[model samples]
Target: MALTRQVISTLQDNGTDIMGPDVMAYHYPDASIISGSLLTVEANHFAVLKSRGAVLGVYDTGQYPIQTPDKPLLGGFVTGFFGGNSPWQYEVLYVNRAKLLVRASGVATSAEMAEMVYQVDYYIHVDSKDDALKLTTHMPFSGHYIKADEVASYAAPVVEQAINQVVQVTPMEKINEHIHEVVELLKEHMSAFLSVFGITLNDAKVLILPKDDRMRELISLRAFGLSELDAVRYYTALKMAERGLVSAPNMAVGAPFSIGGATMGTYPVPDGHASVTLPKG
Candidate 1:
């Protein structure tokens, strides 16, 4: 096909900060490329041409005037000419190169976690150009909704599996201490798991989603480094405040005694003994 019109095309991204707060998307219609076609791609953007679900070529920032003498038409209008150059049909997808934030979760399988749900906040980004293997393996596209599995299918599941493993071995009381360790482990594993998708795990965050009010209280207690006694004291204070009774000084004095006494015999002993013993005598 011979080029006929002044074809003007520019990389169009729905400003990542405002429009695509959560996703990477392109809003441009597919176009026919001629030798004189105007193309302007900016930094932090990857312009890609794909035919039949296969990526043909990847272009970087700057202007590109399509050279079509040797490039044959994939399939499109016949009459198209640009600076005496023929046209070729291809779909263009503008990929956002910036790192993205995503959230993923999985149901815990361990019997100990029967009442809690595990969640992970993760960061993912495209692999560096220097990695020859990732250049070929990583998924070409990311999904729009972190809530949806579309773009996060592989990455999310891999992260969820990693988190579940960590949570299984970790005591609920000390889970926060090992969160960084779990994130580091995920980084190493996802390098291989997500290689086929050409993405990398940049960062990860782990959290326990509580199942009930009690679980919530427990989590809050742990977060604030509060003993159960202290938590009860604070809770009682809140309730008392709600009822509009007792001044702060009086509540403070009454709180510790109430919580301490109420919790005295409630503490559990070791499985083997009700009290400390001096040993066989």
Candidate 2:
């Protein structure tokens, strides 16, 4: 087999913002790279060559001859340019290694089955050659450019899954108190899950709160020296008393209570026994 070097054409990504901040990847419309053509990859970008769902080669930030004389067969994709202008039909995808922002917001079920609303703003990027390949292979986009929205769309479910994984084991009352821990756990889970798609879950800021007023009230009660059971009991009793189901004046708990236009007072407790049990929230 005679290896011939032919400069049929030149292939290189040219643009002011070749790999912009929000861009994830760029698919060159031309799916053919002639042998011996110069392939220029910008900094913080990777040029991946794939043919028929197969990745032929991955070039980093550098200039290289696609099919050099040294290696006639470019990863076995090119046998020879016998016709002298033969082009290897391979998809050219430029993956940005620069950090990109992906924001995800969703509702997760907490340990007590409470709906927890979460909003996460995180940065991610294809860190390595393997990750770049993973990004191109796992998350394929049809258009010429892959934008942040596309990355966000792919990451939203993963973020939701991570939130559920962490929130499901965490009680609503402790969500805000242990928020830092929650953020760490979310980052850990998200990083692991998104890595499968070649996306690195970089630094993130996660804000989680109760989805409704009832859950908010419950969490607030827990913040004020009240246990989960106590918070629920107090919250439920307060609601019941507001609705006139429980007697306001006859209430016998130490906590202060006040309803609209009602006299504010602490429930009196009898000696040698706990106060009346309030219905669960």
Top candidate by TM-score: 1
lDDT of 1 by residue, 27-145 (tens): 23645554555555556655665544565666776667655443453234333434333334555555555677767776653336645576777676654432312333343433321
TM-score for candidate 2: 0.61
lDDT of 1 at 109: 38
TM-score of each: 0.62, 0.61
Model 1, global lDDT: 0.54
For every candidate in turn, the CA RMSD to the true structure comes to: 9.4, 9.8
C-alpha lDDT values of all predictions: 0.54, 0.72
Candidate 1 residue spans exceeding 4 A from truth: 1-21, 25-28, 51-56, 69-88, 106-111, 127-149, 219-237, 244-281
